[model samples]
Target: MGSYQDIEGQLRGKRKFFKQYSKIEVDDLPDDWIDQYYENGFFTRQTGSMITKKNAGEVSILTLAFLLLSHYPNEILNITIATSDFGIIALKNKVLREANSPPLQLNVTYKPPISYLSTDVSIFNAVKTGLIQPHDISSMRPNPKSSIFVEHFADGSSGLHETVIDTPSFVQICENPQKYTIVF
Candidate 1:
């Protein structure tokens, strides 16, 4: 039986370790860290999707997951893509199947949209009138630096391939559907 002080000290050490670990940059990771992440699995989040076609926004988001994992190889990762479109999920499943990767846990949840006060009425009107495309709205578009795809894949010089779906390591993880514990 450890003393209360002993337990507290252990927890404090763990907190400090995690704090430092979270601050690690991609360049700081070990040379083999990406391989380790592929072997151990990692987390990814796609908050929303605007398109679900094969070569559309959903694919970009999925690709972003790979780019993010590559960028943050120091962290443990899980994949959570939240969207109203079933097609997005289906595409994920298809990719998983094609890749033959390890079983990945997934949960599907639905939450009703929350109403919020809008001060962007003029912007909305402009879009409705076709005076400005939705993409033309600064707020509607994500900041370039903030996007994993834009940061790592858009330049075609990142050395990291954008077509992560074809990667054998990713494909291997998709192979084991029986290991998946999906919740709806």
Candidate 2:
């Protein structure tokens, strides 16, 4: 019972995110959302202009997707994705693995894509793949203005929301947690 308008709104959210972060022109956005980029490797005029091939090589759209969705917890709860890329798949895998081991009780759901996802590795992996260009990832770290607390899992694992900080890393953070905030 969902209307195309609802879907468009979500896509619009993505467009707004691109505009806000990348500083691309809103009037120059492409009409089609997912299909346009998925089919034609070329991004829109403004998008392409802002994100040079070199900068594009450094950004990952999947990372932007995760960050954008994190900001819209409500919309993510209401929607469901048919399929997702390896970045998302990887998050689910890591969360599930953590849940099985003792002392690493990650109270998160993996089946529903929106409920569980967080990690820098997934972001990096998405960059390796052609799913997203480098310009899509945000340069700004989460909770940059404040001190962020991090918890690391077994064997140097990571997730979308969990910022893993070890003893040595924690010491480095303690020096200036706010300035050196890893994630939030």
Candidate 3:
């Protein structure tokens, strides 16, 4: 996905698909992937920050859920996106609408926002410490030079892994959806 100007530059001919919708067709995209224009109307820059309030570029929660279901068609998946953004929270209504629509059946539940989430705190700290650079903030997968140590299980298996925010890692995760999950 990209800005309208970017999509226009990539198009072979001057033609728009789903003109009324926030989507377009790009010859460069994978056959199964939908090419959507980055809708600036749905996002805003955060105060005193280079990052946008939406954070995850053009990736919508519905798209993430769809990718998950497509990757694990045989399994029952329970996907949840916790956020303090009211715009994202409002998407629950859209989720309900799509859930009731034909061809896609989804069972969705909405919960009240938690007062605080530790993960959010960690992200802020990471950004403040320069572990997550400004350029990394909007990337599909921010490959930072820094790494973090993580213990997998009681098997004593542990190692340092590249520090990446999963939610914005849509490109990498889409290539292997089963190997990753969207954390936002």
Q: Could you give candidate 3's per-residue lDDT for residues 30-124 as a string of tens digits?
A: 45333333433234344675656353532465556654554565573455554434344336456556654443444333332212222433454
- Those runs of model 2 whose alpha carbons end farther than 4 Å from true positions after fitting are 1-23, 32-35, 42-87, 90-113, 116-184
Candidates 2 and 3: which is better by lDDT?
3
lDDT against true structure, model 3: 0.42
Of 2 and 3, the candidate ahead on TM-score is 3
Q: What is the TM-score of each candidate against the true structure?
A: 0.24, 0.19, 0.30
lDDT (tens digit, per residue) of candidate 1 on 41-91: 322223476322233556556655544554554462465665433345455
List the global CA lDDT of all models.
0.40, 0.40, 0.42
Question: Candidate 2 — worst ten consecutive residues by lDDT sum?
Answer: 140-149
> Over the stretch 74-155, how does candidate 2's per-residue lDDT look in tens digits?
5665333222122444544544554434433333334434432233333334545545444544442232222233435556
Ranking by lDDT: 3, 2, 1
